[model samples]
Target: MSAATATPARTAPGATTLPVADPAATRRYAWQVLRAHRGGVAAAAVVLLAGAFAGLVPVWLVGRMVDAVASDAAPSRLWWSAAALVVALVGATALAAVARLLVARTFEHALADLRERTVHAALHAPAAHVDGAGTGDLVARVSGDVDVLRTTVSRVLPAVCGAGATILLTVGGLAGLDWRFAVAVLAAVPLQVWGVRTFGRRAGPVFRAERAAAAERTSRVLEAVAAADTIRALGTAETHVHGVEEVSHRAIDRTVAGMRVSLVLTHRLHAAELVALGAVLVAGYGLVGAGAVTVGAATTAALLVHRLFDPVGILLSQVDDLQRAQAALARVVGVLSVPAPAGADAGGAGAEGAGSPAGHATTVPDDRAAATVDVRGVSFAYDPDRPVLHDVDLRVEAGEVVALVGASGAGKSTLARLVTGTVTPTAGTVLVEGEPAGGPRASAAVAAVTQEVHVFAGTLADDLRLARPDADDARLRAALALVGADWVDDLPEGLRTAVGAGGLPLAPDRAQQVALARLALTDARVVVLDEATAEAGSDAARTLDAAARRVLAGRTALVVVHRLDQAARADRIVLLDAGRVVAAGTHDELLAGCEPYARLWSAWHRGRTS
Candidate 1:
């Protein structure tokens, strides 16, 4: 909620993250994202099956030619066999190409749809979760993870499938040549199983750790960039640089560990394949020497077994890619699973406590239009160990302006966030007109203007339209004028003037005025201003303050006041200290009854007089 960006702590070594607790469940959830293309998937599978069987024709032709040569067959017979082999190879390559193309086209469509769904889920996720994860983590999921998945599907996936098909057809060829030769290859199966299982166990956690580290590194860099100005003014660039370096080292360390695992896996797989090939040769030679099969037949059996090794080798090479995709899939699935806050799109929270006990928060009536608020027994903490707001109960009657005056970290902003339903309280409830705040229509019922008044990258009209899409140019101008921003009319394009990043430059106060104009356009009854004018210099702050007062005249507003002069005009003032309301009443009432309030007022008044 703070405008200043937060610099996350350096990620520790061996740190692993998988938001979803169960990998199997996560996979099931991920499948739903791709399920729309079941027809395409089926078509690809059919093509793959046809292509694999067609490719086996060359193997049969090779066996025929070998037998013909060993038997002193006619030259014409040998030439025919060679010609047939050429034709089979050409056809096989063409079929394989078609199969690969089909799979690629289908998966590309699925990936695009999945990405859109993931973006929707992230945007609708609870604000608490978004803030907790930080910008870097979310960006990695949508950008890095999605890109990796795309590469896996496009390249590694077809390779894996083709390898499996080749291996199966080769095994069948060996069985047809001589069943004894096939048994030699089968004997090495147990070793292969053991190696794969061992490698999978070692590799899974390392892959997860690697993904998490990359995200942490990205977050560190972004945090440093966002806080560059603060670091320069405070001379903490060296400190920030050190933090980024530590996280980078941790990420590299995880990657190095994964490489080591891959090496071990590769060596073990090769050893198993070599051992099986040696057994096949020995068995084939024995059968020939005993006259159980001809030399040509033995040669054919050995060739098929050796051919099996190439595809099996290729299959093993893709294990690392598959593991990476698996980890990425789990993360994407985890994020998509976060449930959207109830009534987030609607004006109020859904039926009060649908499954909640009868004594839970009551629902506000749909007809209520007053700007009243009820924060009952509300307590909150970003970190549970350190509470920010403690069992604070408060109310602002319709049309009343309550000033919340407090020192920094006194839970002023947190209280305001809860009131606007931008954040949920850890304990108790906050309601606007009896509807739980932060409901589907929460933003429409209780709007906020925080210190970070963003003018989104778009035309001035686009920014204003965010508050009320149906508002016209006349309405936009009227709103701007209400906030004392007459200079908007002086811009080259007026309401159409470009603002925000790379657009027309706006002085901080002017941008804030744009924010107020947007707020003026909202139909939200309750308005919470959390030091919204704190960005202005003293001279501008007075002008902004006057403008704010004019705009808030008939609205129910909860202003987190930084200036005592603002508090002087409040219908009532709630003084917060260490997260509790120590006193409440008018300026004279507080000065007479509250020592802290009197001292704060006296200190401020003397400073102003001097």
Candidate 2:
């Protein structure tokens, strides 16, 4: 409940962390965005400075009117000062509004460019890096941190710019009225400097910790939500709920600590302002009494010092916001720091730097109609110490469907990912039609569907069109029909029906059908389906299997299957155990000849019958 009661947050050991750009890099990236809009920034600055000066005119006029009354000056002079003061007030308001508009437009353009670059970088980033960092961290960076940065840019940026201009111009006016009035304000400088330095020192680590905690909290919440069904099935909902609460509390604690530091800074700043105001008033009295300056000048000096309170408060409070923004910015820029995997951009055959290491041909060999997958002595490990796959080898000829049958963690999915170019082999090579699995050509040749399918928030046609942007409504319908998604006919709007979040909620089976339909629309010559039907019910499994058969027709395919029936239909079945291919043959051959395969099939049969 209280900031003092909250403890500092600490990261759990082995927690996933996405990259974070250093402070200098963050500043440089920000400068680059600003530099691109320098014309607008310059225009805003000039208008803001002129507005700040215009604001001072009213204070000057009030001081002149005071002198005029004291001296019994002509009434016409009073009228003129009053009229000039009103015009000055009007000009300041108009100029300030224009400056704000300019600032918003400039920063908004920069923010849009940054947002685009961040998304582009995230899309092109290495799959392994993204996976290792976890979806929450990436989502928080791209969505959460980006939003925070956007607010800071749109709101805080303009406010800070205006406040800074007003502060500087007001200080100049104070000196112009009487130099000692400016000197008196310096009495508070030491405290202000100390307060800022202390706040920065204390707030930086806490805010960074707060951000990390927030990311972890987001990751936990996302993980729990994603696995909600599994968690309920396992009767572990309470455990997951507790995990979310624990992380949420950690985030709250860090936030509270940050607030505590900010409060301390605010108090110190207020104290400094009081000291400065007292000194200014004392200087004003001394000057007026000594005949060094008139009462009007003294009043003007006090009024100018008082005017600083609002802008100065804005400047100091924004210091807290600035720290938070910088932290978000560092995370955002960090996304851009992830380098694309080597050869990711190597276009069709013999493109620059497309050649892979010896014994591996990652480049496109030649453009061909039929696609074959070649995995030669390929080994891979998510962790080097714990290899998921060993020196295994396999090949699928064009139009052949090879089912990879294995128990859990047998590297079937890993192999499928390798073939699909989602990952690379640590040793040996994976090639699609003699092109490296991850190279541009091979990537275009391969399309995959896994158990987890996402239906983007859009019309059915828009979702299908992602696979082939040029696909017309006829093609989309054909693809959907080919996948046996008759449910489309039941939809209120057919191909125009909205799906995904905020639209028609699709069942897992229907979503997978959409994914398969998208696959049907692609011209991919190779397909990898990793437990693509694992989530379907028995009835739905048969439907999905039928749809998959139609989609995989005449394609080099690797299907990772848990159900023995799916493997039974494959042209050849590859039974993987541990990290090696223990058996490879037709279903009958494996059942008759391989003890492991026979036992697996017998167990699978028993389970199905039971």
Candidate 3:
């Protein structure tokens, strides 16, 4: 929860690690994703190998044709060899296309599986984890980084494999023709491989820095956009713009540096390749002149040498691509490595071992009725050194409403999160109907309505079904009615009306009502209303307050209210100050006994009347 627990160690100099898709884990996850396309992967590999073989056949045929011509072979044999060369070329081209299509399809299937898992993890990770991980970083991982991986897997890997196999085959063809020429041509490989390795190790870290810089720039840009209004209102637009500019400039500098390294490496390799080709040509001519090799054999060696180095050059050039992919993979693996939230076992013994306490049990007239909540000595913090709540103790009996009153940052919301199971306490425990609060099973008994109510882009019915996926139309309507969201029926499409993004935008009050409707649909026995009515106006607040009381009827409720008038209506009121409970009693009792409560009540009355 404390800033995503710091990113994994930086692999790039002067750049902090960005959570890109994890390469090792992504590769492993990709295989899992690819398991659904095992047949396609196999088929694609076969087609690719066949294409590579065909490509090699052309090189071999050309070498043979060269030998035939040099030896002044019969015209008929020459024509046949030329024809075979043409056929091999055509066959390889055709097979290459087929292999490409197969690989693309397989890659897409794998990408689908990865995207699904990433989205699932993002949604189901604990609130602390999600909140600590910025939205921009996650978006970049999902959209940008994932796309990079998909491209490499679909295009680069297959090409590297096919090209490499063809290059090897071509070299073998040269070797078969004349050993002396083959040896001369093969001498270039060790030099090229060594050069690639030297450049690759240096280039890998540079490319990684370039990628992290890009991610950092992206996160800053997103932050700027999200806070555009605030920045403008605060007269700090220049400051935000400057921050973005700095990040972007850093990214550009890193990218330029990476490219410069690649350019220098390429030039060095090109010089070596040119020298190798020149030596091959000179050696072949000398050997033919000395009668150590026939003219046809010399010509064959010349042609095959070019073929051999073509893939080598290509492989060396793509070292940059490989570096980028590897960096992206590391970022991805970092995210996947975050341990699953505590008490998240959905299978095996842990699920069966879950239990509750006896003190918090509530007798239900019906199985569908609500439960009590018990909190004892709960302490928590986003940072251990700065505790947000210390030894917070509170309880909500069945059918009782408790209101928490506090100034901003006084740990009211932190307590709500603890009770709702969005965050676990650093010490002590929370119990729902005597059950130890852990995981969704315990969370299912608690619902929290916070200041920000997210209305996902979907039909009204789609949004409502999030809380109760199995709920029928009647049940959905009932939940909506309970929250006074019956106005939904008046919309153009009723239950099917679009409600987010490009769809009809709901006023804040209406959005809060929709959230309450979701809470009503949930199986939660204890509802925590944290500033649920803060976004609504006086009239809307009155309507929402009425709806809340009706929907929460006979259910335990913890209301964190800013408006002390509202707190006065609760069956009991608890005052929190600097992360500790200062007082607890009925509103009248607090006014008579607690100075903080009396002062807060006076402020609320004055504000209401004013």
Candidate 4:
């Protein structure tokens, strides 16, 4: 069987092939996330310490009240002790509330900053890098994973810190008052700690699997929703639904398994606490009988042991939450680690000189744009051992229009990408002016409008401003008009009208118009239109073709024409067979000399006529 046929169907993005967690890696990721918010971490530490200190006051007050009662003090002393206890409890509660508020605020702000940074990193990454990563996974990292961090920093971590500190202080206080009772109260601590350590190791892997499953489920749901129309047309709605269900089921199973481990740990902790309480009671009674401790002291020890156990239980219970947060932190850190694309600033004497000729000035001119694009002995393969474009040699003059025409999958789009600085040739250099074309200036000089035009969520004015942020209203209108979008002015809000999702949805033709308008706004010296008008109907195509020709009146353009009529109007038509340019000349010259060109022209003409 062929390799493709032998392989099983692809699993959903974020699916885990193995359910093993690395505790060391998880700890490292958690530390990185915590360090990212130095200010928040500092605030959390301060809040936790203060809360722990406040919590200790109640235990101290309970001991003082017990001592007073056992001594059979006067009514005045007894009443004073009761009032002091009340005051301590009230003060502790107030301090805890303030600390909670401050910690929560700091954590939320830090999470917001991290989320923004991750998004910025993803946006600046190279297109090829982004294509390798799944959009759904990136989205989950920003939205869901960051949220988990917020919860951990704000709710779980502080509680764990405060509870642990409180337990330690309570134990110290008890030991100072009566050593035997204190020792008995902490006798089961070793067992409890051992159980926690054993289960904590398993918690990390189970939680990681659970998070991955949830991310896969989310990706599937998003795919199904986005392609609902295709699913309906292909009668594959049920299949997609089943895929979603499978992911959901796996997620539920992982979550339940993690929770089951957590429940066992909780039960063990509770049993340990009960055993410690029993030991404390037994030791307290024995000390009282031997006259080593007062009756009230023994009572106070039991009460204090019970109170300390609450925080201990709370600390143990939050281990699962901490594990989940660490898993999330790993995903977030992974996203932030993606390097951004390199580019040149608008600062060079040559670029400045070139700009001055056109009345366009920049603070810096890109030296790379001065280089010539030389694609000599170039070859490429998206997959190893399966070359697509091979040994291709092509060049264009400083001011020349080169139209590339070919059958489907002829590597035309890949060539355009090579020229636009999106991809580097595997075997040869793609130079811009003379330098290698892999920087911002080269990208700016060589602009491309692909078949799919992305319209961001914004007003019409906002969309136009993307091409030239400082462009005035007049410039925007002029560009729109140049793309034959004169009807834009007729909209109710004109330039202010919303244009993307949650706004007025533009038809495919109108979207193409917007893209062409953007190209005009860029005013780049070299423009590559890779089937930019493929989505437009025939009538709209003709109008757009005329606008395109007018827009390229004096500029260098590489037009990838699908229709022969459009190719006939280009300055030169270059026909490709396999990966090499087999014919290059005016349309009539190609039709007269090249059999492939003539057949393609005849077929396009018939299709257009029909």
C-alpha local distance difference test of each model:
0.76, 0.83, 0.73, 0.71
Per-residue C-alpha lDDT of model 3 across residues 1-610, encoded as one tens digit per residue:
1112225444333323334443445566555656778899889889987887788776666667777876788999979988988998999999988987888878777767767766655544555554555566667676777778788877786677667766767667766776666677756767677777877778877877787777778888998998888998999999988999998999999989988878876887777677667878988888888888777666667767776666776777777777777776666555655555544443100110011211133212124566788899999876556788989888888889999998988899888877766577889998877866655455546667876787878998888777666678898899788878879878999989998888889988898888888776665667788888774338888888888888778778889888776788899998999899999999889999999889888887777678
Error of 2 at 171 (Å): 1.6
For every model shown, what is its TM-score relative to the native structure? Answer: 0.81, 0.91, 0.87, 0.84
The RMSD of every model to the true structure, in order and in angstroms, is: 6.6, 6.0, 5.4, 6.2
Better of 2 and 4 by lDDT: 2
Q: In terms of lDDT, which candidate is stronger, 2 or 3?
A: 2
Candidate 4 RMSD to the correct structure: 6.2
Clashing pairs in 2: none
lDDT of 3: 0.73
Q: List the candidate numbers ranked by TM-score, top first.
A: 2, 3, 4, 1
Could you say which candidate leads in lDDT?
Answer: 2
Candidate 1 CA-lDDT value = 0.76
Which is the better candidate, 3 or 4, if ranked by lDDT? 3
Summarize candidate 1's per-residue lDDT along 1-610 as a digit string, tens digits.
0111112233333222324424765566556645767888778777777777767776777777778888889989989988988887887788778878888888888778768877877766666666767778888888888898899889988778777877887788788877888899987787777777887999999998898889889888998998899999999999999999999999999999999988887887888888888998899889989988777677767777777777787788679889998888777776676665666534331111011111113322334365679889999976666788999999899989999998889998888878766578899988877778876544455667776677788899988877666678998899888889989879999878888898998988888788788777765566778787774348678767877887676778899887788898889999999999989999999999989999989987887788
Query: Please, what are the lDDT tens digits per residue for candidate 2 over residues 281-318?
Result: 99999999999999999989989988998899899878
- Report backbone clashes per prediction: 7, 0, 13, 11
Q: What tens digits encode model 4's per-residue C-alpha lDDT throughout 1-610? A: 0001111112434222211224454455446556776776677667666666666666666666777777877778767767877787787777667667766776677667768877875665444444434466667777888889888878886677778767877788788769887789878888798879988889878987788788778778888998999999999999999999998999999989998999989988988989999999999889989999877778778887888778988888888898788788766655555544455233111110011112245312322222235677777655445556878777776656778899988878777777766556667777666656656556556566776777768998888776667778998899888989988978889999998998888887788788778767664666678887764347887777877776666566677877777778787787777777687888889889999999998888788679
